[model samples]
Target: MTVLVVAAIAYLTLALILVYAIDNLVALFFPDAHSAMPLNFPTLEKMMAASRKYYRK
Candidate 1:
């Protein structure tokens, strides 16, 4: 049915958006959170890299 198809599409869109938002937030606030993981995947490294450094003087 057309209604079912539309609902499915909307659900998928929302799911994608949710994942993107979470990834951005994690990258922003907890970039090194995954650094200790044993796996050395390139994609994981990029995702875990921080956009900016924090320092105290």
Candidate 2:
């Protein structure tokens, strides 16, 4: 049980870090598209908006 709990915590930490990295990368690569969006993990809605804005260019 203890090991399981430790593994879950580690997995969540990694997931959060990965999301943050991806968010930053998106903002870096698509400044205009991401400028109006909040600085958080990319949800489906945000991704769609960014893609739409990018493709519109």
Candidate 3:
């Protein structure tokens, strides 16, 4: 359990770093520069879209 917790934390940290690096790289290579938002993203819109698709009566 302890090992799993440590691994999850490390995994999350690495994933965030990789996302930043990739976002930077893409922006550097693309004509229109894209940047990560400096704030948290909410999943409610995505969740609602998915729910609507699957839950239509």
Task: Choose the strongest candidate by TM-score.
Answer: 2
10 residues in a row with least lDDT, candidate 3: 33-42
Candidate order by decreasing TM-score: 2, 1, 3
TM-score per model over all chains: 0.53, 0.56, 0.51
Q: Which structure is stronger by lDDT: 2 or 3?
A: 2
Candidates' RMSD to native: 14.1, 12.1, 10.9
lDDT of 3: 0.83
Q: How many clashes in each structure?
A: 0, 0, 0
For candidate 3, what is the TM-score? 0.51
Best-matching candidate per lDDT: 2
* Cα lDDT of model 2 by residue, 1-57, tens digit: 999999999999999999999999998987874456566666767888999999999
Question: Which candidate order results from sorting by lDDT in descending order?
Answer: 2, 3, 1
List candidate 3 stretches off by more than 4 Å.
31-57
Q: Residue-wise lDDT of candidate 1 within 24-52, one digit each (tens)?
A: 99889877755555666885666556433
Clash-forming residue pairs, model 2: none
Provide the overall lDDT of each model, using Cα atoms, as 2-decimal numbers: 0.78, 0.89, 0.83
Two-way TM-score contest, 1 vs 3, winner: 1
